[model samples]
Target: MTDFAVSYFGGRVSLRFAKGVPFAIAALVIAVIVVGITSLLAGSYDLAVWDIPALLSGQGDKTALTVLWDLRMPRFVAACLVGGLLAVSGALLQGATRNPLADPSLVGVSQGASFAVVSLIVLWPNVSIWARPIAAFAGGVCAAMLIQWLSAGKRGENSLRFILVGIGVAAIISAGTSALLTYGQINRASSALGWMAGSVHTASWGPCAVLAICAALCLPALIWVVRPLTALRFGSELAIGFGLPVGRAKFGVITLAVAMAAFAVAAAGPIGFVGLLAPQMAQRLTRAGVGAHLILSALGGAVLVSAADLLGRTIAAPIQFPAGLVSAVVGVPIFVLLILKRANSSQL
Candidate 1:
């Protein structure tokens, strides 16, 4: 799996693979470049790939420029921001909870966001679209706060216990969302389901503007959380011993993570597993601990989500799946492999 090129048919139809160290190093660079270019170039139109230079110089055709500037640009920017948001939230959650499986969605963040959106659609169907992100952000952070409280001081932390609690909370909220939609007076279930699945199909400058503003407001707070995050890894005692304001810091981080998840969900309907996969992959690739460079993890996240989105759109063509679906289908196996690897190593 380490080898880059595999030859067959007299080396005429060679295949290639990348994994482990070589994969991490080479893939990081290639992923950054490929994701950036492909993300910019992809869309409904047929632009000349070689004509990228003209577009960069603002000399491309009007239609091509429209595609690049209007349609593709916002979506591409969203992919990067939403992706980074989810990944950072994931890394922070994992570090805070000292759980490899911790993610924004797991602590009911996604469910909370979904609930707020679904309620908006059902109770106030005529409400303007501009307000959905606001509601979702409010609900998601509240849920995170609640979950953090519940999980606090729980020792050796049974991962399954956390998962079960999360699932239960999520299930209840999901049922509430469904109930709101199913009510004859307000059957907005379809909208709820769609949002739950995650899609950026309706992405535009509006949500993009909101996302950017939130990122600017939230990134500094997130960075502050990172320092405490490192202290948190050796358990809350050491964190408090280091004079880190453990409880307040954890609350702040969970709140920000919730907001990030909510913003992403509002913009792209709860894109699953980006949070779960990105930091884990970064760790595996760099052999770094949870407290490693936040910037690298963020970039890794952006590349992953961007590439997955590209794959989602291109693989099926006219009837492409959403990027979120693409991640679940692709990410589940990798998640399993990580679990199996951990289990095997533990027994040995």
Candidate 2:
């Protein structure tokens, strides 16, 4: 489809999107809304679909209101926020690194955040849950810095080196996290395990607000990176030849990505594969500019996570599965298919 550009702010800001992008984005938005409504209505504590209007209007049974507002609503919101953040993060990483397989978990952001949050849980159980995002952000930043330092040298940045170093760092951090889980107190470790499993069942309005605030704060950064991402995709040398500050742009993109992933992990634990899969899904759905691609990826991620959470809670009735587990189960086969597709393309 052809592209259309819209100018705003006296032409200082413009967004270009493919003709099909709007349709794809609308579809994803509808999917998210449907998943969210279904999540709110279907659960162990039944809430009739027809009563949703009354309940939302504040005229429902007290118990139903409590279940809807306090439990289901927050969980659904959290899933959307977390999924959107992670998907955007993954899109950024893939663009910045010029690696189709790059994602938060693959590149050490999730593991770093997990390490910090798990340490807090296992070592200082009395700390407020609100502190998690801060710790996670710090850990993720450190990890990103480490990867950058290790990957850059006399020849400048190397995408392959970056991915390799990040994989090694992620593995080390994951090992540390496992050790903490293994040696820590059983009760605290169990609590940490539940969070690490990536279940949003315990999500409340507090964490939901935090995730929303983080997403809002990242909005400008997202817009700023669109051009850089598009340029970077053509290769670092070409980006530099085009008068872009390749190093600064790459650093900024990676930092933005890390922050997004860290916030999501802090709020809902590390939900796997959403970041990895969403961008690919978006790309396959429509050929669009980076801005529209990111929008599609975020919406796709929200749908994936919200659906995963819905299925987790409803599929087995009272026996709930963690959304992470379900997403992995669904994502792994898709991931394998992506790998095979890439391999076949390279061969051709």
Candidate 3:
């Protein structure tokens, strides 16, 4: 379907959108808001739905205020931020590589961050918790750089080569992480396992602030990549024919994607499948341009993670499952379905 275009500044500025894009975006926004509110209200602590307004206004009881603000709010915010970041990262990766199967985890970013954080937990148990995010970001960047270096050749970067190298690097990193968990101090390893499970149960204001800052920093990069991402969907050769610096554009997009994924992993461990799932879901929901698709993906991701976290928290009462586990349980079947569909189409 062709897009509807709107012009402003005597056509100097224009925006184009697919027919269903607005509705899809609205639905996703509503879903996120609903899930967030539900998450804030539904937890181990009994919070009446009506009490939310009072709590928000600071007119509620001290304990209620503490529960709402100190405990639930941070977790809610972290889940949304992590989900949105991962989804956007995934969208960027899929566009840059022109591969529907592309994801932050598939590309080694999540594994790198996970390895760094796990290493800290297992080997440097006494280190300050504040350092984990730094370690994660550094590790993720290093891994991405390695992937780029390995993938680049005399002919320039190949998307297939990038994916293959990322897979091999991710495997090696995963093995190293597993070894740390296997041989490191038992108690520390256990703690690391909890983190690796990707729970936001311990989310606090500091990490929330850090995540927000990372998201803010990424905004400009996201905008800058929109045109390049659109061009890249047609392949590097075609993008170059259109006068785009395909190599630099891919590098920039991948770098931006890595930064978003690493920050999310740093904030909330490695939440799997979100980066893979959200963009696909958004695309299926609406035939939109890259920018609209990204907005929809971010909102969809926020809803998915927030709802998963809420279910994990309330489903079994005091015993809470990690958000990442819940997401995997939901995502794995859908992922398989997508693969089957793709395979069938290829055969057709």
Best by lDDT: 2
lDDT of 1: 0.73
List ranges where model 2 is wrong by over 4 Å: 9-12, 149-165, 340-348
Stretch of 10 with least lDDT, candidate 3? 339-348
TM-score between candidate 2 and the true structure: 0.93
- Model 1, stretches more than 4 Å misplaced? 1-30, 149-156, 184-188, 287-292, 337-348
**Higher-scoring candidate on lDDT, 1 or 2:** 2
User: Candidate 2 lDDT, tens digit per residue, 316-343?
Assistant: 9899998999999998788677657666
Q: How would you order the candidates by lDDT, starting with the best?
A: 2, 3, 1
If scored against the real structure, what TM-score would every candidate get?
0.83, 0.93, 0.91
Please count the clashing residue pairs in each candidate, in the order shown: 1, 0, 0
lDDT digits (tens) for residues 1-348 of candidate 1 = 443566888987654434344446556767777776887777669776788788878996898988887777677677877888888888777776776776766668888898898888777879888788799889888777666556544354555456456767777787787778677253466666666677665577877888789788887787577578878878878888999988887777777778778888877887777888888878867554333445556777788777877887888787767888888887778767765665654421
Candidate 3 residues 1-348, lDDT tens each? 767889999999888999799889889988888888888888667899899998999998999999999999999999999999999999998898786767888778899999999999899988997788789888888898887788777876455566678889999999999999999999999999888998799999989999999999999889889999999878888898999998889889988988899899988888888988999999999798899989998998898888889999889988899999999998888867765766654421
Query: Model 1: which ten-residue window has the lowest total lDDT?
Result: 14-23
Between candidates 1 and 2, name the one with more favorable TM-score.
2
